[model samples]
Target: MAEELQTATDKLEDEHYPAYTMGRAAEMLGTTPGFLRSLDEVKLLVPQRSRGGHRRYSRYQLRLATRVRALVDEGTGLEAACRIVILEDQLEEARRINAEHSSHQPER
Candidate 1:
């Protein structure tokens, strides 16, 4: 029982865990459910679905949503904002990979 409880607690710390329901996620982002749904429509941040088929979001998804929200607030179009976020994510990943590769290279 203690192990189960610990595992549940550990999941909460996981950034990829689908811990927040749509409504809660929207509320956290200061947006409406419709906005989140729009994100899914645009194929930006497709959240996980619960057993009953309700959308559930992870902390990483919320971070992406927050970036989109900021862009939209700054007068960017929804589709453009999603594109920018995708590019940004890709660039970050590429940079991470490059850094890791550099660290493993032998000295000149």
Candidate 2:
């Protein structure tokens, strides 16, 4: 029982865990549910759905949403903002991969 509880707590701590409902996620980001739906409509951050078919978001996805929202607030179009965020995420992932590769390479 204790192990199960610990595992559940670990899941909550994971950034990829879909821990927040759409409404709660919007409230946390100070945005409206409509905005989150727009993000979803654009395929920016397609959240996982709950057992009942409600959208559930992870912390990682929420951060991406926040970035897109910031760009939109600064006058960028929704599609453009999503593209920028996608590129940023790609760059970060590439950098992470490069760093791992560099670390694994033997020095001359």
Candidate 3:
């Protein structure tokens, strides 16, 4: 029973990790595969490459793509939207790093 519980917990943890192929990501985001590839071409959202050179979109990338779509629908130009998304992501990452660093600092 303990082993079964551990397995279930592991599976849930894995699900929390980002991992997805371009096709699957497209289906989930209500976009086409070509659209994703175009995003890559325009430097909007680049996916990771597999051993075979196929594009693989992680959950993070998919969420960013969705944001891009939303911005576009809201009257933002594609290039501007992409730039905004990149900047926002960078800001979020910096915040996370800063928080982690502060948390690990030695007590005065």
Global lDDT of each candidate: 0.97, 0.96, 0.82
TM-scores vs. true structure, each candidate: 0.93, 0.96, 0.72
| Ten-residue region with minimum lDDT total, candidate 2 | 42-51
Residues 1-108 of candidate 2 have per-residue lDDT tens digits of: 999999999998999999999999999999999999999999988899888999999999999999999999999999999999999999999999999999999999
CA shift of 106, model 2, Å: 0.4
Tens-digit lDDT track of model 3 for 20-99: 78888889989889878878988977677889888887667787899988898899988888889999989999999999
Q: Write the per-residue lDDT of candidate 1 for residues 1-108, one digit (tens) a residue.
A: 999999999999999999999999999999999999999999998899999999999999999999999999999999999999999999999999999999999999
Flag clash pairs in model 3.
none
Q: Which residues of candidate 1, in runs, are more than 4 Å off?
A: none
lDDT of model 2, residue 5: 100
Cα lDDT of candidate 1 equals 0.97
Model 2 off-target regions past 4 Å? none
Model 1 per-residue lDDT at 82: 99
Candidate 2 clashing pairs, residues 3+ apart or interchain: none
| Residue 85 lDDT (model 1) | 98
